[model samples]
Target: MDNQRRGFPKRCQCGEPVVLKTSTTAKNPGRLFHGCPFGRDGNWYHTFKWTDTSMVEEIEDLIEKVENIDGAAMTLQKGVNACESQIDTLAMETRVHLGVVEKEVEEMKMQLRSLKNIVGFVMVMVLFFMCMY
Candidate 1:
């Protein structure tokens, strides 16, 4: 049954159903594969792989290249997303810090104005008493 023709259904060890493709060979026989539906589980329950015959090797290489490109794309997208999030976070933090600084400056200005008013009132009081004397 291992040498069965391509496109045939084969039973997995766990009783999962899989289809053998046209890439089976003599040496590395019996590899199963499936689409993205089974990708998360780390085992392709719906398909299998075989040895590297000349024809199979060419096809395998092409498939490997395609998968590599896909993986690189995913990594790049993830990196970009991470960088964007970091930038947003920094912007928010900067805005909050600026707001705090502005509030502090306003408070200091008010205090200075109050001190000036008190000094001016004391000077006028002294001048009035001195003139009377």
Candidate 2:
């Protein structure tokens, strides 16, 4: 059973209140744990999880969370990169469109200059013919 998911034991499965105690066994001397008062040493029927083991499990869960966050971050980074690429493409397109508009403006300026010269020459010829008559 995953006792780690259950977290710190408040009550035993046997419907008895758990209390903190120290292990007196040779294998685990002075180890703190929570268990029912009715629980016996080396008994598997009762809840008797080691405190240190529970903490280790907690740390493992945190590591898994960090890994999940890292994966999410990587996914977000990919999205940002795609957005940047799209922006670059749009910028290039804009520059090309602006260049075409600028060329048209230059052409219009040259046409305006030619029209002005033709108008000035016609006005001078009209005045000279009127004076001759």
Candidate 3:
């Protein structure tokens, strides 16, 4: 089984519970971070470095960072929102294309049935002519 506890839970650095908006990775390993809405201007929490011992201190530092990094956090938020919008658009388009393909498949089935009926009729006519002969 995979070690599911890869990072710390979504909490702030100040040992105070902050509302977590989202979680994203950073350039460093074991340094995943979260965005807290409790900052002075609702900025991103600092990148929390995870260690086995000082998890509390790490969470506090992250809360302070979130209070500090306003510009960087706003950029990240915009990027996330844009990507989500694009994904929603793509999902809708895919659903529409799937519907069209399903309709075509149904039409093809109907055509196949019609062709089978015609072939059956021709076979019966040939048998009748043979009997007359």
What is the number of backbone collisions in each predicted candidate, taken in the order shown?
6, 0, 6
**Model 3, poorest ten-residue lDDT window?**
1-10
- What is the lDDT of every predicted structure here? 0.64, 0.87, 0.64
Off by over 4 Å in 2: 1-27, 33-49
Candidate 2: count of backbone clashes, pairs at least 3 residues apart or interchain: 0
lDDT of 3: 0.64
Per-residue lDDT of model 1, residues 96-115, tens digit only: 99999999999999999999
User: Which portions of model 3 miss their true places by more than 4 Å?
Assistant: 1-68
* All candidates: TM-score: 0.47, 0.62, 0.46
| Candidate 1 TM-score to native | 0.47
Tens digits of per-residue lDDT for model 2, 8-82: 677888989888899988998999988889999678778887888767777877888899999999999999999
Which one is best on lDDT? 2
lDDT of 2 at 64: 88
